[model samples]
Target: MFETELTRTLNIRHPIFQAPMAGGPTTPDLVAAVSNAGGIGNLGAGYLTPEQLRGAIQKIRELTDQPFGVNLFVPEQPEVSEQTEEAVAQMTEYLNKYRDKLGIVQNPSIKKFSESFEEQVQVLLEEKIPVFSFTFGIPSLDVIHAMQQQGTVVIGTATTVEEANHLEAAGVNAIVAQGCEAGGHRGTFLKSVSESLIGTMALVPQIVDHVSVPVIASGGIMDGRGLVASLALGAAAVQMGTAFLACPESGAHETYKQKILASNEDSTEITLAYSGKAARGIRTAFMNDMQQYPGEIPAYPIQNALTRDIRQAAAKANDSQYMSLWAGQGVRLANDQSAAAIVKQTIDQAYTLVQNRFR
Candidate 1:
């Protein structure tokens, strides 16, 4: 019953998108399950290597023939100034305390910080994936055009109307209107994080008015209620992350899934501790301690690499305090059902709402 430009353009039965959550939660099984259920499932390939990305794409293809998307992080060359070096040193020393507690070695030798983004993009081109999406910043026009040439729908993430305008001018197929209530990293590339903190209700319609392309509303959206409200506000579709974190297909740690089911709306907070970028997650002891640190936090990928060992070790120990439990404010509504059930329930509820309430 719910069909819009996004559904028609993407060739999907529903206008729902499973937000491309990076790390472990967005597994190929999860992605394919959503597509099989009529929603577009997205693989968050930002941290994946070229070989790993190819393997994942193959895995997804094996599971379902439906269209799916792969999301990448636009690379940022953080200026390595003397101050940045100092901050890295300070943060490294501070994070050592957590290592000691987790019973892991301190100050492990670090060589590589991030995966090769260019090689990752090349895989997408060669594979001719159905859709390509990115966050943090826009890709070059050449890259965008290349994706279009291959008939792959390209989507960009935006936190403000101005960002949406910039993306439209750059010739994107669609723009995801990421709101302040979104979980994980903030995709505010145009303005300071504090300035781009617009809620979904306010951000979606303004972006829809500014840009001619379809706008996908993200952040804090959980159920059929959010889906109908976003459509009412001029959104062509809705993207959800936290809503799927607790799904059985999700690769999130067992402890993390439990936390999502047990937490509430007030349990999450945005912090720069886990990765230098500001992202929302359920508040933990690590985040609280980092808040009191007198030194500046290193830039993303740097800070992300520095704390990798700690997060991994905590996972092995089944300790939730140090893991990056990325989740949105809609934690109270998260379910522990299968991915197909979640998608079906959402569409059914949306249909009921439209039938009984709208008409």
Candidate 2:
């Protein structure tokens, strides 16, 4: 019975969204389950090709007739200026050490940095998906309008109040206020990642006040307490990534799941070592060692592509040290449950707690 602008706008039953987790964690089953459970499940399409993204959407449709979302990365091509060659050289030298350690003779250069964002958007429009979301930066007004004309509800991620303002002006149907504690890449383009650090408590209300669109609070939110707290701060819904990482439907490796259950509040840290963008994850030996070479690193798709082999090698060997264990600050609160079960539990617990306290 809990309804908010998010639910009303998206035509979903509850004000919960399974925040899209890119790389390997977000599966069609997980997305479908969330939508089927009355909350919106968003498939992370940032790392997928246009063909792959289309197939995934088709699979989601096969699995659920309910509302769901598909997310894409707003392409931000790094400015390769005078420091470009030096930075690439430094990054290569740094990766060479890992290549030697992992006993790989041939290190494949990053061929295709990222899938085409424009083509991806076209696929979303062709599919007529119920909702669409983008992170990293806001898409242009033309792109947003095209999708909207096709009846797509657009959502954009923002890390600071200024970014929220940009998204609002860009005409996103809603804004995801991604606090500093959020896992994955921080969606901040207006400022450097270091300067955009704002906690959920501070960021949400400011964004809620900054924009007229419905604000979905994200980052460090887990369970019913976080849900109720976000609503109190004027959020229409909560987008949780880490809370769903432990669910049975998640595609996260067994080792990654273990780390989530073992982590505490301070176990995670924000660093640019992984993808050359600030993202929160459980600190690993690799992250610790790469801390020194951060400035030399290239941005986004390039850095992400460069680290793919080593991460896969670590995963195959079950070496948690070298794997990118992306998570939020509330990892310890995670539990082993189905995605549907988690959604139902959060709805029941939050509604009961709110009624007990305010009604």
Candidate 3:
């Protein structure tokens, strides 16, 4: 077996982690399966309430006593101007069509935005979970210290070298070097998302050279080749999101799963139309329509809340045209398999590739 500080620290048989994919793709069963397969699994608790997060943690614990991680979305409060509201209003006609399909008479208003980070941290401390990961931004030093005091291994996600340095300075136990090719929301901290677009191959080695802590490479890593390349670049481990989306135990909707398997490398696009923040996903008609009326959309949670109902309806109808099919540029590399099978295959193959290189 390949040995590293990350593997020893996390007490895992392999240096692989199932990326915590938020917005329904990550399920407790999937997490447990990966953990049971001797890799670290993660729960994406970005959208869950404190109670819900606790419940999911309980379920994961019930399934396995192995070490796993929980990921949280660091809150960013973006100011909404009149122009943003007008931008969102432009989608009125498009959203109305979904109202009829979903049997809704009243237009849904924006729900209040809140991140239960403080409360959720308390839950983690109380539960004494092994690892706590954060995305979108890093938490304050005090918060990190608090979690560290409770023996939680803190990990921060970064889309750039500057963000990785910031995370190291803030005392993160390790850094997840999230590249531009990663799926879901970009976790840029220092610069605008546009300026921070570095691909995995270019970003991983640089962060590994610069950061003091262990670097966990994340992005378009899909198979054994990707894993071997990451290790060669000095990564202590690799975290994969899109690679696991096609797993049978994933919580992704049927339409989302089908679309993932059918997608080519060029099928995904980085668009803010769905959540008012940049995320990579398969191109859809709703995305195209939103582009025609771009400037009016509200920021993040507001825009995210505004379109919740339409997205729900679209999922129920198995309509890919309107759903947020988040994926990485390596969508074409995904395989349809059970989570346990995928984990075992990746670990075994990666080990073989690493051995061949040394020989």
* Whole-structure CA lDDT of model 3: 0.87
Model 2: per-residue Cα lDDT over 258-308, one tens digit each: 999899989999887777777899999999999777566788777877788
Candidate 1 has which clashing residue pairs, if any? none
The C-alpha TM-scores of every prediction are 0.98, 0.96, 0.95
After the best TM-score superposition of candidate 2, give how far the Cα of residue 188 lies from its true spot, in angstroms.
Answer: 0.6
| Predicted model with the maximum TM-score | 1
For candidate 1, report its TM-score. 0.98
Model 3 C-alpha lDDT per residue in residues 89-180, reported as the tens digit of each score = 76655567667766765466665555567888778878888999998887888888888898889999988888998899889999999888
Q: What is the lDDT of candidate 2?
A: 0.89
Question: What lDDT tens digits, residue by residue, belong to model 1 across residues 115-227?
Answer: 88889999999999999999999999999999999999999999999999999999999999999999999998988899999999999999999999999999999999999
Error of 1 at 198 (Å): 0.5
Maximum-lDDT candidate: 1
Where model 3 places Cα greater than 4 Å from the true spot, the runs are: 78-94, 97-103
